[model samples]
Target chain A: MTVPSRILVVDDDADIRTLLGEYLRRHGFQAEGACDGASMRERLHRAEFDLVVLDLTLPLEDGLDVCRDLRTRSDVPVIMLTARGAPIDRSVGLEIGADDYVAKPFEPRELLARIRAVLRRTTGKASAVRPEATRHIRFAAWTFDPTARHIVNAAGVIVALSGSEFRLLRAFLEHPRQVLSRDRLLALTSGSDVDAFDRSIDLQVSRLRQKLRDDAKAPLLIKTIRSEGYMLACHVTEPA
Target chain B: MTVRVFVILVLGILFAIAGTLHATAIFHGPPFRPTLQLSVLGICTLSLAFITARMVTRPLRGLAGAATRLGRDIDAAPLPVTGPTEVKDASMAFNAMQRRIRANVSERTGMLAAITHDLQTPVTRLRLRVEKVEDDDLRARLIGDLASMSDMIRDGLEWARSIDVAEPFGRLDLDALLDSVCSDAQDAGHDVVLREESAAIVLGSVSALRRCFTNVIDNAVAYGGRADVSCVVDGARAIVRVRDSGPGLSDHQLGSVFDPFYRVEASRSRATGGTGLGLTITRNIVVRHGGTVSLRNRAEGGLEVTLDLPLAGAE
Candidate 1:
């Protein structure tokens, strides 16, 4: 008899708020809607919410402002819904203690996956609060800008990673020198929503190894453990 | 004003010639040493003509340089109105024209940004609402249509952004960039191959150049089924050829392919899913980097897009 997670959807458009509310509810969450920041604050005051899906473009007081204010008072997870191609807003949202972001015009399934991933990460207490400051993750001659979602090599060349590749790399960077099982890797990278298999994880790992220029037969950076899983054999550092 | 300057220049030269002749007649004896006098007159006329020509052309040269600067940067400073009356008038007119063009460009960009920004909310709403459709087939088709619509909207915004030259230029490895783009395309299951690459370093806006190549490759993949890309540095220019295996375009279509909204196969574009602005944006980015992009039907049966970019420190 476990209670479902409570979610709050904050958007100016009534139709959007209602639709997202219904969608979240149908996905087994107790969802509530707020038309703007003022009502969002009132909802928070009245009830407890595990997550807040805040839209960046809201009337009068915007989502960023609301999220910033909420961060000062509470540690509740905030997921920003930003416009596509608004990279600045996305980075700023993440910098302001928001947990994750889903670009607008996104697939509903994608949003659901993001919501689930954020909830899982938060509840698991893997580094309780997301680092408030934006930092670049450096590992073995590669620099990863989590905000920009790209990797730069020692030669100062930027390499763009596909979404899954980025998530996989981030997971490895976050936990270096530890063998990550296929199931754990899949959960971290694709969330639980995707019907991915162990082979897909292997394929993704091989592709990533190719990008890193690591030989598959005798890999140097990412080593495959016998009967265990993959482990990043390099030291990872987060440089400001 | 120019005519007046010309008249004065002519009069000054005539006076100098007459003075030189008078001096030669008075100073020299009977025959006047015609050879020396003629040489002296020729030297005087030549010196006067050279000085007058320089004086007149200096103002024109300044105006020409300013015009060239304006062509490269719309926000270039106005020409200094400190020359002869005609030159001043011409510069003033040029400055006014520059101002008008800047205003118009900003206005159009602002409007496009506003429209794109406003469209996102409703599109998102529609996407969410459409998910509730009971019929699975109808829902999938509706989602497909919405996805394409969103793609067009996103492309429109990108096209508008391509006009902005605010991106910082950096030295980029052409081979590495091509490798990444091709690899990414391959990862996406697009039939793209980087057949050849050279260690070519180019000075360009990294994102803009990336977008340019991506659009070209995407276009090739969408229409041509596959893209065979090759890059080589020839002397001072890095030449990249993206060859596609699609049916080659007609001569008329080739001429208009880069034109905005001009799709070679209009009906095919709907199926392939592009706003027909890919090549247009590609050209915009290439030209901004002082590069030239051209498309031609391959002799063997396909279309080849050639991009010639100046290597870093070469130009």
Candidate 2:
């Protein structure tokens, strides 16, 4: 009795667009495709989509540029499509606000799973509002607010997080001072980066730590527990 | 006389002797007859001097031809060292220049390829997250777009990496190579049949040739429904032809097929998921092996891709 999540596909390939559109529809989602960045912007302006699947290479403007521009406007979750064996450029893509990336020649099922996971996390509070009237959570001299989708440092400067990173940090904030393993973090974040064998969580954590100005050797907020995983050492306080 | 002066003196003596013999019958061997003989011999000696001068300049002409060929074909055989010492030294220098150019090109290609390969991982991660969208439509579209873009990147990167001379050259059985390519196509659910495979051996980089055949056969199957591979000896050259049953290319598109990023169909839609660099790489490989690759629109409503390699042991 609810509307299906909307997805925007940005690629220049017609067959891929048609096949993916039909395939996603069969699985119960509303999917539309744009051939390039200009068309993607037009579609974004026309409708409110749940997520964007962006390809890095395009005709007029590239997917990286699109991701950068979208980051300035919306907090919509972005998954990048990258070439097989292209590792160096991947870091630049991640730095530009993309939530995750997948290699080419991927299985359709894997793609479907990723889509479902991202939607579940980004739309976690759909329909049902958190009846708790408070909008912010305070943890160890830091303030995290899902409504604002940002974290305020001790100096009160808002540090921006990408859609999935925000979700990940929120998950950490939700259970402060507890060790959260990779699987738990993956489950909480629910994006394409949470593959069975992927080490993206560690990388994301490192990135998050860098932004938070937390020392890796002696992390104050999030500490690594050797082989066990990660623990948020900060105490969380939700505003009444 | 010493050797050099002896040769010149001998030439003068022979001319003088011939003059004396001609004068003996003309008059009784005195001043009038001797003077006439010397003048006649002088003309003959002058002609011989002119001929020797031209012979000495022949090496310079050969050097010029070699220089011209070197400019046209960077990989042409080294210039001959049979000329004078200075000319030989120049030839050696030219060969060294070619080696440096080849080395530079190879190094650049290697760096580009390495950089591209290193870029794949994070892009893949970003792609996976996009796939996790709850909206089924958005998720699928995003994946499709990403896949195509990835293909483009791969092709672009591969093309950039193709300038290297890493492909090892060796003797390959032309028939066996064609058979393997056909089998690969069959494995990929393509209808590729060898019309007449020659058992003739080719001295080439086996891996490069295999890749070339793979690209051509793949195109044949992807665009054309079937492939017909065959090999024949034309004169002293071994020619291999791959015919496809797909809609043949236009006359104009034939020449452009081997150019990088040149798709016959301008749009390059998903139906034909080509990055337009396959044929370019194929040509580069073939040429690296001292072979030539060409494409022609077959009159029988299909396209024919042909490769001409110099026959092994053929003069």
| Model 1: CA > 4 A from native | A1-3, A45-48, A73-75, A120-123, A126-133, A191-203, A206-220, B1-34, B58-84, B266-270
Model 1 quality (TM-score): 0.85
Tens-digit lDDT track for model 2 on B1-315?
156456667777888787667867577644455565667787768866975565556767876787776654566777666555776787788778878876777677677666666555444545646755899998778878777766766766656645544443455556656765665466456788887746566776554576688889989888888899999878777899999888888767886888877887843767777878999988777776667888877888788889998766674
Cα-lDDT of candidate 1:
0.81
Query: Relative to the unseen true structure, what is the C-alpha lDDT of residue B21 in candidate 2, on a scale of 0 to 100?
Result: 77
Interface RMSD after interface superposition, each candidate? 3.6, 21.0
Candidate 2 chain A, poorest ten consecutive residues by summed lDDT: A126-135
Candidate 1 chain A lowest-lDDT run of ten: A125-134
Predicted candidate 1 versus true structure: per-residue lDDT over A114-180, tens digit per residue: 8888786566554444532246778899987777546778987666565567678877876689999
What is candidate 2's DockQ? 0.03
DockQ class, candidate 1? acceptable
lDDT of each: 0.81, 0.71
